[model samples]
Target chain A: MSEYQLPAQFEEFSQARKEGFLRAKAIKDSGGHIAGTFCTFTPCELMDAAGVHPVSLCGMSPEPIPAAEKDLPKNLCPLIKSSYGFAVSDTCPYTYFSDLIVGETTCDGKKKMYELLGRMKDVYILQLPQGIDRSYALEMWTKELHRFKAALEEKFNVTITDQALREAAELRNQLRQARTALMELQKLDPPPFTGLGLYKLLDGLGFSFDLHSNLKKLTDLTAQLQADYAAGARPVPPGQKRILVTGCPIGGVLEKTVKVVEENGGVVVCFENCGGIKPTRYLVDTQAEDIMSAIAQRYLNIGCAVMTPNSQRMELLPQLVEEFRVDGILEIELQTCHPYTVERYEIKKLAHDMGVPFLALDTDYSQSDVGQLTTRIAAFIEML
Target chain B: MPVYSIGVDIGSTCAKLAVVEDGRTLVHQMVMPTGWSSAETAQAIYDQLERQGYCPDSSPCVATGYGRLNVPYAQKTVTEITCHAKGAAFLFGTEACAIIDIGGQDTKVIAMADGVVQDFLMNDKCSAGTGRFLEIMANTLCVDPGTLCELARRGSGVSISSMCTVFAESEVISLIGSGTAKEDIAYGIVESIVNKVASQYGKLSVPGDRCYLTGGLCESPYILESLSRTLGLTVTSHPLARYAGAIGAALTAHGLARSERRTSV
Candidate 1:
C-alpha cells in the first residue's frame, strides 16, 4: 500500500519476517533452549556458547496491549504493555518457548514489565550500571557479565569453556561484520537499500540462531546491492532526502514509524537505535585473554540514553552524520519513555549545532497519530 | 495563452484549490468542506478550474495536507509544513517568523527563515489544541462557531482545565447544569484552546518572535486576540491565510512545471 515499493531483495526479507517465530520453533524442537532477551545489552555470545538459541523479545503489536491492561496500567509505556500483552495472549511463541527471558535494567517501564513477566516464565534480571564514568561501574558490569555467564552454565547444565566463548565470539563477530558491511552501502548516493528493507534484515538477527546462514544471505544480498548499483539501480530516487533515525528501538512490533518515514519521501540511511548499528557494529576482542571480560567491555561502551553522561553517544553522532551523509535527523521517543525524552533537548541542540534540520516526535503504538506524524515527517523532508 | 499550475490541499475539514499562472499570479482559489470523498472533491475543483482554460498537460499539479494522497491528479504531494512556509514567505517576503497553523485535527508550529522551513512541531495524537475540539464545544453550547467566538469576546472569563476534549465537553455540560452563564463557558472554551496552543508553542526552541496565523481558525477573531495576548507578541494573518497550503502547493507546481520545461528544452 505504500507509494514507494521496496526493492525485490528487501521484499524477500518481508517473507522471512512472517516465519520468524516458526524458525525459532524449529530451533526449539531441535533440542536448543531459546534464550529471549529484552535489551541488546544481553550479549548473544554467552547464550550461543551454551548451545542456546538467542532471540530478541521486544513486542511491536498494539492489539495485545488491552490484554496487558488487566494487570498493567493503561498509561504505561506502550512497548512494555504490548510485550506483556504478547506474553499473556500466547501470541508470541518466542516468549512462550523461551527457557530463559533475560532482562536488563535499561528503563523503569521495561524493568517493571519484566517483573510481571517473571511470574509467567523464568526471568533473569541483568543489573546494568548507570553512568559509565563512575569509578566502579565497569567493574560492576564485568562482575554481572560473569554472573550472567554462570547463570547460563547453571541453567543449561553445561560449563562454558574459553574455547566455546571464543567460537561464539567468532560466530557473532561474523554476523556483526556482515551487518556492518551492509550498512556501508548506505553511504552511496541513492542508497541501494530502504529503511524498511534494512530494518527487516537486521531484525532477522534477533530471532535467527544460525549465524553462518545469515551471513551467506547477507553476503548474497550485498552482492546483489552492488550489482544493482553498477546497473544504475537505486531504491530512493533523487530529491528524496536521507534521514538518520534515533530514539527507541523499533523491533518486531514498532515498525510503522519506519514505514511512515519512507512513505513521506525520506530514505532512512542510518538508525541510532539499539536494533540497528549501535550493538551490531562493535565486536568482542577475541584475542583478549578473558572473553567474558571482553564481551562486557564491548557492551558497556554502547551509548544508550540509560547511561549517565552518555558523551560517547554524543561524540559518535556527528561522525555518523557525516559518514551516512544525513540530510536530517528524526528522533522518535515513545510516550512515557523518560530517559530518551529527557535527553531529547540535548539531541535537539546537537542538530542545531550541526545545522541539520531536526524533528523530535513523541508517539505511542496507537494508529491514531499516523496522519499527524506523516505530516510532520513530510514537512521535515521538505525542509531538507 | 498561459498554462496554470494547480495545487490542491485536501485537509481534514476542508478541501482548498489554488491556480497560479506565470509563476507568480494567484489566478483562482476555491475552498470547501472535504466531506467523505477527498479525491472526488479535488477532481471537481480541478474540472472547474480547467473550464477556465487551464491546460493540465503542460502544467504541474501538487497536493498537500491530511488528505493529500487522495488527490488523484497530483504530480507531487508535499507536506503542509513546506506549503505553509512557502505561502507565508510569499505573503510576508522572507521574514524570520513562526507560522502557527491551527487546522481541524492538528496544530503545527513551524519555524521558518529566509523563505525556508528550519524546524517544526505538531500537536500529539490529542485533539485538545485543534479546531475540531473548539467545534465540538461549540456544538454542545448550541451555538455556531462564529457566534461562539463573538460570545467569548463579550463574556466574562471562566477557567476550563480538562485536557481531553470529551472530558472538557462533559465539564462544559456541568457548568451549564450548575447555572453558570453560557457566555462565561464560551469564554472558557476559547481560553482552553488558547492555553493548549500556548503550551505547545512554549515548547518550540526555534528563535522567532514574529508569528503569523494560518488555517481556518484564522477566521476566528477571538482566537487571534487570545493568541496575541497569551504569547505577548505581534500575531498577524495574511488576508488569504486560509489558502496558504493551496497557494504554496500551486507555487511549487509552477516551479516543477518550469523545471520540466527546461529539461525538455
Candidate 2:
C-alpha cells in the first residue's frame, strides 16, 4: 500500500498523457487501471471528495470519435471527435488510469460519449440534466453525492459515514467562506484582491480536508474582514467604479485583466466563471438526501448561463447589477471556450442595451500573456 | 425606396456582420464571439447587428460560417469560401486568384476563377494556422499578434512539432525555460503552424494570376512569408482584408441586388 506507483517510463504531465500511447503500442507492455476524462479545465471536486485521484482525461488524438461519428453527424463539434478519439484509438489515457469511468452530461457530445466508449471496463454516468433548475439542481447534486459515496465505498472498501460528511462539510464551508470573503474584498476601493488570490483560494474548495483548524482559520479571517468591512475602515477603493466580470475560467492572465480594471479605478465586484464559482460555490449540505444535489444547487448560485441557465441567473444578474450598482460589464472569453464566447455575446448586448457599458476581451488560456487584458480592462473602465 | 442587405459571417471565433444599403456598403460591422447553443450564437449575432442599425425588424440578412445553421434571421446562408471568393473578386477583380483564408476556428485555401470557388481545402480540426493559432502563439510568447509576428520575422531557427494548443503551449514553456531564444521559438512556432497548414492544404492547385490571401491570418506576415517560402508561392494581401468574408457576403448581396433590380426593370 505504501509502495510508489510512479511509472518507470512515464514522467511529467505529457508523458502521463502519452503513457497510453506507449501502452497501446503493444498490449502486453503495460498493466494498470486506465481512465479518460474530458479535459483539464474541469476538475471535478467530487472525485476528490471520494478520495479518488482525478486526472484530466482525453482520448488518443483529435480524431473523430469513430463509434459516435456515424450517428452524431459529420458537422458535429470537434470536441466530440476528440472524445471518440480516446477509446477508438486505444491510446486513450482513460484506458490506463480508469478502473471505472465517470462521465457528466456537460455537453450533448459528452453526455452521449459514454456509449461510444462502451468498451470501457465500467462506465458510471451521473446523469445530469440539460438545464439548471434549483430544485432539480439540488436533486441532481445529491444523487451524485450518494452515487459517489457508493462508488468510493465499493472501491476503497470503506464507508463514507455521516461523520466524514460533517467533517468534509465544515472544511469545505471554510473554503467557501474564504471565497465569499475574497468576493467581498474585490468590492474594496482600489481592488485589494486579484484573480490569482481568488484562484488560489478556490484551487481546493471542493475537496474534503481532515484539518478542522485550517477551515476555522479561514473562517476567522473572513469574519475579521467582515467586521472591518462593516466598520467602514476598508472603504471601497476611492473613485473606483464597480463592475461584474462574467466569463469562463479566466485563463492564466486574468490577474492582468483585473489589474487593468483596478488601475483605471474599477473594482471587480463578483466573478461569474466556471473556474471562479464552481469550486467556491459547490458546498454540499451534509443533512441533504443527496450530497451531490446540494453541490449542484450551490454550483447554480454562481449564475452560470450554463450548468443552469434560466430564471435564477436572469434575476440574479439584474439583482447583482442593481445591488452592486456596477457601472459596466467585462466579459472575458478564452479562445477555445465557445460556450462562454456565446454567452458573452448575449451579456454584452444586454449590458449595452440596458445602458451599462459592455466590453469583451478574448484571449488564450496562458498565464503570463495577461497584459493584453490589463490594457482592455483599463480602457473599459476609462470608457465607463 | 432604397434596398438594404445584411450579411453575416458566423466565423469559428467571431461573427463578422455587415449591412449594405442600396448596394453601397453601410459597413455596419460586428465582431462578436461564437459557440454555445445555435440559438445563443444567432441571438448574439443578431444582438450585435442591432448595434449597427440592422435589426431583425428592419433589414433582410444572409448568414455564413461553419455555424450558419445558428443564424436565425438570414434570408440565405452561404459558405465563407464562396463569400471570400466573391469578396476577393470585388477587391482584386474576378480574374484568377487563390484564397488563403485563416479564420478564427479554421484555415481555408480556396481557388477562385471568375469570382467563384473552383475548389478548396479546409483545415478545421486543429486551429494551427487560424486566428486561434495566432492567439495561442501570441499567448505563449507573451505578445500581441503584431509583436508575435515581428518576433518570428527576426529569426528562422528552432522547430515546433506539435499542433495541439495544450501540448504546444507546454513545449513553448519548456523551451523557454531551457533558455531558447524568444524570437527563435516564435519563428519556429509560426513555421510549425504554417507547416501544419500546408499538410492539410494538400497542394496549391490553381491557375495563378495571383494568389490572394485573406482572412484573419492575413494580418500575420510571418505566417504568410513562412507559408509562401515553404510552398514557393508569392502571396498578395490588402489592407482591411479581415473584412474579406464580410465583404464577400456583401458582394453576394450586391449580386442579389442586381438580380432583383433586373426583375423590377
Candidate 3:
C-alpha cells in the first residue's frame, strides 16, 4: 500500500460491505425478512414499508463468473453472469439469506438470468416498460409496484399501510438528499477526495442496511469533507482534468476505469451511472395522493439506457457536465452490454456538441485489459 | 553548447530512437528489432546513443509505446496515442486532419485540430485490424509481410470474413487446401484488414478531408491504395511515417528540456 491513505470515513465506508453481510445475517437469524434487489428500479420503499431489509444483490466481482458460465452463456454481460453465479454457488450472504429476490425486466440478459435464479430462490419479476413517454407506461409500472407490494405483504405476512409508505418515502428522500450533498462536494475547485475514494463510498452505501445510519454517515462525511476543504485541505490536485463518467453501472470495473483515470491525471468529478447520481437525483413524492404511483414515477424516470429514446439520460448529461465543470466525458460499456454500447454514439455526439472530448471504452470484469485501459486513459488525460 | 532531446519508442515488434536538436532538427535516428525483452532493447538504445556521441546523461528523453516504462533513462513517458498524433501533425504539417496508425498490436484513428488531438478511437482488444493481423496471415502463407502485400495487389474478387486473427488463419488454411490461389487469399486478407480499419475510421468524426497513414505498414503502396479506396478518401504516407511516435516523443522531450532550463534560470 502507498504511504498516502484514504480518510478514515472513506475506510469505514469501504468496510461497509463486509460488515453489512454480518448485519444482514443477524437480521435473518432474528426472523427478520430480507429482500435482495437487482436494479435501481426496484422500489425499496415498498420493502421498507413492509419492514423488510432491502439489499442490493448486483454482483461487482469476477470470482463467481465461471460458476455462472456453467449455466449461462459466456458472451452475456459480466454483471448478469456474476449475479447469477453468486446465487448458484451460494456464495453471497445477501443472496443466501434473502427471503425473496426482486428483479425487473430492464434488459434481456438479466431478465433471462432471473429465470434461472428463481429455481434456487424465490424471485419476483416486475414487468417494466421500455420507455416513459407513453401514458400507459406509468400506469403499468404503478400496477407492477402494487403487485410488488402485495408480494412483499404475502411473503412477510405484514400489511404496508399508507402511513408506513409515506414514512418510508420521507426516509428515502432524506437518504437521497444526503447522497446528493456528498456527491456535490466534488464541485469544489480541488475536490476533497479522489474519484476512487468517492466511488468507494457511493458503492459501499448499497451494502449498508440501516437507512437512518446510512443517512447519518453520508451527511457526516459530507460535513467532514466540507470542513477539511475550508481548512485548506485538497486531496485532489488542482488542474487535473475533471471527468464525468457516464455509461452502465461501473462497480464491477471501478478499479479499471475510475482508478485508472485518477492515476493518469484525471479526476472523475461525477458519475451518471446507476449507483451514482442517476437514481439518487430524484425523490419519491411523499405528499402524493397515491404514494405507490409516486415511487413508480421516480424510478421510471432514471436515465438508464434500457429505456427507449432514453431522453432522460440525454437530458441529465449536459446538466452534469455543466454543473460538474467536466473537462472530459468517459463512457464505459461492459462487453456484450448492447444498450450502453449502442447509446454511446448519441452520448459522444452530445459531448462533441458541448465541446468536450469524449472517449468510449468497452471492457469486461477480467483484469486482461488493464494495460490497455491505462494507456487509453493516460492518453486521454494528456489530450485534456 | 547545443542541447539535444532524445525520443525512444519501444514498440511491440520494433524499437525506434530519435535525437532532435531544438525540437525541429533531427540529428540522429536508429531502428532495431525489439527481441524478447524491452529492458534489454532500451539498454541497447542507450548504448548506441553513447557510441554516436550523444550524451544520454544531459539530453532530455521521453519514452513511448508499449514498452515505454522499460526505458530506464527517460525523464518522462507518454502513451503512443498522443505521441503518434503529435508526430503525424508535425510530419504532415497540417493542424486539421485525421491519422490512422496501424501498430503491431493496435490500430488507432486519431482526429486533430490546431495541431492537437481532438478525439481518437482504437481497435478493441483484438488483432483484427492491426499490423499483427497481417503479419500472422503472412506467416500462415509462408511469406513475409512485404511479399504478401506485393502478391495481394495481383489478386482480386476474394474476401476473408472472420474478424478474429485465429479464425482468419484457419479460414486461410482451408482456402489454401481447396486449391485457392495464394495471391487471391492474400488479397482477401489485406481486404479484410482494410475493411476493419475503414470501419473504425468511419466511427470517428474528424475535422478535415486530409487523412494520413503511419506505422510499419505505411511503406506498402497496396495497403495505402486499398485503404483509400475503402475509406473513399486519399490515404497518404511519408517515408519517415514509421518513426512518427519516436519523433513525437522527441518533440515532447524538447518541451521538457526547455521548461527545465527556464526553471533553472
Candidate 4:
C-alpha cells in the first residue's frame, strides 16, 4: 500500500476508489474484463452493461512525458504524453489491468498517439466527426456508437440488452444529478465550499466508480453546506472574486494554475473544462425511442474543442456565467493544443460581448511558470 | 492628525521602502541591494525610519514582490502587479495605460484603466528580457551597466546574434576576441535587449500612446532611446520609476489604515 493518506474529508471516497482498483484486479484475475478510456467520447454505458468496468484515465503527471521522447515529439500535449508515459512505463494500475483500452479521435495529437499506444496494449479507436454542424455528422457518430457497442459485446461475449443500456444511462443520470447539486452550491455569494474543494470532489467522481456511495457523499456534503450557510458560515473569505475557468481539461493531473488562482485571493466557482464541470453538466436522454441515438446526441453536444464550429459551446458560456454568478472568466490553453488555441480569438470575443472581463493564459503542466501564472491571476482578480 | 503609511517592495535584486502620508504626499523613498536577506533589509529600513523619529511600526505596513510574505511586520501582502498598477496610476493620471516593468528576475507588461489593473503578462521563467540578463552581459563585456549605455551612444550599427543571456555572453566574448569595437558591441547588446523586450510588449493589446516604462533598466538613457527608436513610441518614465512598486504598496497601506479606522469608528 502507498504510504500517503488523503485528507480526512476525502478518506471515504479515496478508500472506496482504492478498493475499486483491487476489486477490478480480482475480477480480471477471475477472467473478467476492465476497459480503460481516455476522452468522454467513449460510451461508458455500453461497457458498464457488458459487466466490464469502464475507467477514464487521462494521464496528468509530467513524470512520464520524457519517456515518450523516443517516439513522440517533445512539444506534444502534456496530457497525452503523461497518459502514454504511464502506459509505457507500467505505472498506471488501471491501464495495466485493462483488458482493452478505448480511445477517441478527439484531437490530432491524441489520434496519432492512439496508433502508437496500440502496439503496447490491446486498443480500439473510435472515430468522431470534426464538424458537428454538418448534416451527416450526427448519423456518422450514431453509426460509430453502434460499432462501439458491438466491439464491447464481441470482446466480452455478452449481449447488452436495451434494458441494460437504459439501466446504465439511468445510473449515469444519477451521477450527473449529484454533481449538479454540488456545483449549484457555488452560486452562493460566499460559497459554503471553496473552488478547490469542489474541484477535488468532482475529480474524485471519475476515479471512484462507486456511483451510489459517491452520490450519498455528495448529497451529505451539500446538506452540510446548506446547514453551514443557514448558520451564517462562509467558506470563501470576503474580498475574494468569483472566477470561472474555461479551457482544456487540467485532468486532475496538474492543478498548479487553479491553486495559484485560489492562493492569490480568488475563488474558482465554476469550470467549463472536460474535467471540471463538464462531466456532470448533461444527462443522457433515456426517453428517446432509440436509446443509442439519445446517447450519441447527448455526448456529442458536449462543448469540447474537438467539435468544429462549436457555437453550442459559445452559447453555453454566458448561461454558465449567469448561473454561477461569476465575476471574471479565465481562459487557459494548454501549450500546443491547436484546437483550443485556434478558438482563443472567438472565446475572448464571446466574453467581451457578454460584458465580462476575460484573461487568456497559455500555460503547460510544468512548475517553471508558476510565478508568472500567479502574477497574471492576481492581476485579473484585482481587476474584478 | 496626519496619518502615515509604509510600503516595502522586496524585489529579487533590490529592496525599496516608501513612506506616504494621507495617501498623497510621499515623505521618503529609499532603495538598497536585497542581497541574501530581503526581510532583514526591509526591517533595517524601518529601523532607520524609527531612529529618525518616524514611527513606521504604528502605521499600516504593506509588502509586495517575490519576498513579500517574508516581512513579518507587514499587515498585508499584495502582488507586484497590483502595486505596480497603483504606482503607475499615481504617477501618471487614472487613464487607460500599459506599464512595462523589467525587474531583475521577472519582466511584466501590465494594463491599467481607471486606476485598476485590467490584465497583465509576466515572463518570470525567461531571463532574456530581464535586468539579470543585462547584468550577465555587462559583467562579460567588462563594462558597468550604468556606463555601458553612454558607451553605446558613440557606436553605430552592429548586431548581436543570440537572445539567450548565456549564448549572448559567449557571443560577446567571441566578438571581443575577433577585434570588434567595444562601443559597437555595447550598442549591439542594447539593441538585443530592446528587441527582446519589444517582442513581449507586442503581445499586449494596449495602444502605444499610453505606454509607461518603469524598473531599474529605465535609469539607462541609451537603452531607453533604443527602445523608443525600435517601438516608435515616445515611452515615458517617472523620475522615481524604481520606487513605483514601493509607492503602490504604501498607497495600499494608506487605504487599509483608513478602512480599519472607519470600521472602528
Candidate 5:
C-alpha cells in the first residue's frame, strides 16, 4: 500500500462553509465535549480540524434522484436533485465524516432541500432569518454566531479566547493585503502574474493564513516570486494588449475561450477565479464585538460570487479593466452558461448605453474554438 | 371570431401543445422528443403545428418546462409551476389547488392560490415519482403509460418497498421471476410513486380538497388510484391533467394578446 499522504490544507467550499467550519473547529479542536453547532454551510473547516477533509459533493449518480422526482418539483435546478440522490443512496462520504451539516437560507431550493434531507439525525441548519436589510437580521446573525461559537465550545470543550480570533483576523488581513498587492501588480505594462499562477497562490492562502509562522513563510515566498521573475527576465511580445480577463471560469470551456483571447493579441491577467477571491478576500475585522457579525458584514456586503442578488461579475470587469487598464473586456460566453450569459447580455446593454465599447465573445468553451476566440480578442484590442 | 390564448409545455419526453379559448383548452397534443439538434426539434414542432393547421406565430406563445429555453419561437418563458397552477385551476375551476406535476426529468409540487403560484419545490435531480419512473416500471412490467394507468386503476392494496430505480427494477425483475402477480407489482410501483409525491407535498400546507396532479405520471391510473388514498382528505385527478402546463401557457398568452389588442383599440 502507498504511504498515507496528508493534504497541505483544509478549505471550505464557499464563504458560508468558512464561517461554519471555523465555528465548529474553534471549539472542537480545542478538545471539548460540547455538541456541534449547525450552520447552513457544509463543515469543511471543522472537518479539517477534526482531521477530516470535506469535499463539496455536487453531482449525483442519477440512480436515486429519479425516485425523488415524485417528491420534488420539476423546475428545481439539477444540483438539488443530486443532493436528494446523495441522501437516498447514502452516497455522501461526508455523511460519515460530518458531525454537523449547516445550511444557510440562500434560496427556497436550498431551504427545502435541507428540510427534506434532514431525515438524517445529526445535520443542523442555521437559517438566515428573513428581513435581509433589517437590524433584526443583524441581531439574528449575531445571536446565531454566538450560539454557533458556544456549540463549538461545548462540543470540543475548547475555550477559544477573543485573542485567538484577533490573531486569525490579522492573518486573514495579511493574506488580503497580499492579494490586493497582486491585484495592483496586474496593472503593470506586461502584467506580473498569469491567471493560473495567481489562482495557485490564492489557493495556498487559507491554511497557512491561520498560522503566523506559516503566513510569514508565505510572505517570504511571495517576495521570492519577484526573484523567480527576475531570474527569468523575459519580456512579453510587443503590440500585444497585456489584458487580464476578470470573469468566472464557469464551463469547462473557460480555458478554450481564454486561449481565443490570447490569440487575439490579448494576454489574460486573471479570471477573478473564485479560488483567488475566497482566501485572498477574507476582509472581516475578527476583533469586533461580534466576530460573526463582522464576518457576515465582510462576506455579505462584498460583491463576490456568494453575494448575489445581481451577478456582480460585471463589477469585477471594470476593476480588472481599469487596474490592468485593459483595452477592452472580451466577455467570453458559453451558449448555455445561464448566469454568465445573462450577465453578458446586461453587460452588453450597459456597454452600449454607456458607450464603453466591450467585446462579447460567445462560443461553447470547446478547445476547438480556441483559435476563433484568440482571433476575435486580437481584433477587439486592435479596434481599441 | 374572438382572439384566443395558448400554452406550450416543453417536457423532457414530449413537446405538449395546448390551445386555450376563453380560458379553456380546445385542443392539446404532445409532440415527440426534442432531438439532439435544436433546429430539428423546432422544425418537428413546426411540422406538427402545420399538420394541425394552426399558426402558433400568430399567437403570443408562452413556453414552460426544462426545455422552455430551447423553444426557439416562444414569446416568453413562464416557469412550469405557474403554468401548472393555471392549468389546474382552469381544469378544475378551483382557486386553491395543490398541483403535483411529474414530468420526465423532475417532479414539482406547487401550491396555487387563485391560479397563481404561492410556493414551489422542484425535483430536477431525479427520475423518481415522475413519468420517467413510470416508464421504467412499465418497461419492467412490459407496459406503456396507457396500460400502466389501466393496471394501476384495476389493482389495489400493494406496497412498493423501494424508491431507487435501480433497486426497484431489480425488485420487479425478481418479483416476476418469483411468480408475484403483475398487477400487485404494478400497484406497488404506483404506490411508491404516490409516496414520493406525498413526501414533496408534505412540505407545503397543502389543503385536503384542492390537490390535483398533472404530467405523464398522472396518466397512470394505478398511481392516481393509489393517490386516491387520503392525505388528511381526498385528492382528485383531472382528465386534462398532463396537458395542463401547455394549456396554461397558451391561455396566458391568449389573455395577454387580447389585452394588448384592447389597449390598442
Candidate 6:
C-alpha cells in the first residue's frame, strides 16, 4: 500500500453518518421534522422548502437482510432486503425519526418493498416514469413533484412558497457543483485520492443535512488535495491501470470490487454509479419558469438502468472513458438486480466498441465470493 | 552454464511443475496430487525439483493457480488465467483462439487475440460446471472420473436436472434407487457438465473459430468430443494441455529473467 495518508476531511466525511444520527435525534427532540428518501429521484427541495430535513435511507449493509428475507423473498435484491430489514427491525435511527419516507417506483424490488415499507412508516410513493424519451415523462414527473410538495405541506402544515422552492434548488445546485468539482479531480494523471476515499466522501455527503457546511467541506478538501499534488504527493502510483466502475450502487460491494481492484495493480479513477458522477453531473435549473418542473426534469434525466433506453448512460460512459483515460471498465451488479444485470450486455458492447476491456461481476453483500473476486480482478489488471 | 526457468502451478486437485530451457524448450515436467495443504505441496515440489538436479532458488520461477501464494521460492506469482492463456497459445501455436480451462474449483472461458487475453468469463461461485462436480458425481456412482466418462459413451435415455454438485449427487442416488442403469446415469452427469461449460462459452464473443481445451479433463477424449459437439466447434487438446498453466508460468519466468539480464548488462 502507498504510505500516503488521506486528509482529515475524508475521515470526517466517512463519519458523517454516525454524527448525523445524533443530529437527527436532537432535531426530533426539539420537534423538528425529518424526511427519509430511498432513491435519487426524490425531490428533496420540497422537503427543504417545507422546513423538513431529507436524509438518504438507502440500505448499503447486509446486517438486516436476514430479517428482511422473512418478509421479502430470499431471491430479491440485497439493497431492497437490507432497506426493508432496517425498517422492519427498527434498527435504523433515520427511519425511526423520519416524519415521512419518500419512495419512487425505480425497480420492481424497490416498488414492492415500498408497499411493505409504507405499512410500517409514514410512506409516500412517487410514480416515476420508466422511460425518459416520451413527452409525458416530464409532465407526469412534474405532477408527481407537485403532489409530493402537497404531501409535505399537509404533513408538516407549512405551505411551501415558489420562492422557497427556487432558493432550495439554488442551494442544492451549488452543493452539486461542489461535488462535481471534487469528482472531476480524479481526471488527473494519477488520481489525488483513491476510489475508496472518494466513495466515502460522496456517500457521506448524502447523510449530511447542512448544505452550506457540506459545500464548504468539499471545496476545502478539493483545495487540500490540489495543493498536496502540486507539492509532489501522488497517492496513487504512476502507471496503474485506470478503471471506471459502473452498474448498480456500489456501497455494498466496495470492499469486493473497488478495494480489490486497487489492491491488485490497478486504480479506480472513476465511478459512474449513483453516488458518483451520475447524479452529481446534472443540476436543477433554478432560473426556469417553474422550479418544480426544472427539478423534475433534472431528476428524470438520471442514467439509471430502471429507465428503458437509458441513452444518458450510453452517452455518458464513452465520455467518461475518454476523459478519465480509462484502461478497463468494471461493472458491479448486485445479485438479483435485474435491470443492471440485463443492461450489462449493452455496456459490454459499448466498452468493446471503445476498445476497452470490460468485466461484469454479479455478487451479493456476502463474503463468500471474495477469493474468486480477487483472482478475477487481479487477472483483469494483469491483462490491462 | 544454461539457465532454466521454472513454472509451478499448485491447483486445487493437483500440482504441476515445468522447467523450460532458454524460454523455448520443454526440458522437464512433473505432476503430483496437491493434498490438503498447499504449503506442504509446494515444499514437496521444491524437494522434487532439487532431487532432479534443478536449483529452484537460483532459477527464475513463477507460481500460479489458486495456491500461487504458497510457493515460497517463487520470484513472482501470476494468476492462472494469464498463465493458462499464454501456455495454451504457445502449445496450440496460435495467437488468436479461445481457451476453455476446467479446473477443480472453477471453469474459465478466455478469448485470446494476438497472443493476449481479449475477454474472459468464469462460472459464478458454483462447482456446477467444473471438474470437481464430475469427481463428486463419480464418487457417488462408485467409479473414477475417467470410467464415468467411458460409461457415458454407451448410455442414453436419461438426464440430470440439478446443476449443483451436492444436489446432483442426491439425484444420482435416487436414480440408483429407481433401478436406473448406471450407464444412463453416467451419461446424464457428463451431459450436465458439458452443457454447463457450453453455456459459459456461449456468453463470450470469441475472436476466432479455433478453441483449445486445457486442464485435467483435457486427456478425456469423450469430454473433448462432448464439448466439441455441444459447442459446434472442434475443441482440440494436446498431451501437454493439462500443464498449460505451469508452462505459462515458466514462460513468464523466462521473460522476467531475460529482462533482468538486459538491465544488469
**Best TM-score among the predictions, by candidate number:** 3
Off by over 4 Å in 1: A1-25, A252-255, B50-59, B206-208, B258-265
Docking quality tier of model 2: incorrect
lDDT of 5 by residue, B8-65 (tens): 6777677777776655546646656654654466567766776776666676677776
Q: lDDT tens digits, residues A38-142, model 6?
A: 887788888989989998888889988999989989998888898889788766768867888999999999998888898889889999999999979999999
In model 4, the Cα lDDT at residue B232 comes to 85
Maximum-DockQ candidate: 1
lDDT of 5 by residue, A1-384 (tens): 213221123342346534544544443455422222222133223333333323334332344456556677755544456456654554333332345555666445656777876776355566555434565766776676566556655654566566655555565567567666665555555655654455445444432324456456556756765666567643444455654453333323445555445544566665554434423454667558865567555544433323344444445555555555565555554343355555655666655554444665555322444433443343345334
Docking class of 3: acceptable
Of 1 and 3, the candidate ranking higher by lDDT? 3
RMSD of every candidate to native, in Å, equals 5.8, 20.3, 5.3, 4.5, 17.0, 5.6
What C-alpha RMSD does candidate 4 show over the true interface residues after superposing them?
6.1
Q: Sort all candidates by lDDT, best to worst.
A: 6, 3, 1, 4, 2, 5
TM-score of chain B of each: 0.93, 0.84, 0.96, 0.92, 0.85, 0.96
Instruction: Encode model 3's per-residue lDDT on A1-384: one tens digit a residue.
Output: 232222233333435544655676677666778899999998999999999988889988898999999999999899999999978876677887788999999999999999989889999999999999998999999999899889888988999999999999999999999999999898888777888898888778777777899999999999998988998988898988999999988899999999889877889999889878998889998999999899999998898999997999999999999999999999999889999999888998899899998999899999988888888888888998
- Give the clash count for model 5: 45
Put down candidate 1 lDDT per residue, A1-384, tens digits, no spaces.
Answer: 323222233333445543655566566666778888878788878888888887877888787899999999998778889889978877676876788999999898899888999898999998999878988887898899889889999989998889998999998888788888898798887898888888887776555566788889888888899998999886677656899989887663345577777876778899888877787777899999878888888888888999889886798788889999999998888888899999998998998899888888788888777777777776777788
Q: What global local distance difference test value does model 3 have?
A: 0.89
- The residue-by-residue lDDT of candidate 2 on A26-93, one tens digit each, is 32223323233453222244544555444434432334346545555555444455556544544444
Per-model DockQ against the true two-chain complex: 0.49, 0.02, 0.47, 0.40, 0.01, 0.45
Q: For every model shown, what is its TM-score relative to the native structure?
A: 0.92, 0.44, 0.95, 0.91, 0.46, 0.95
Docking class of 1: medium
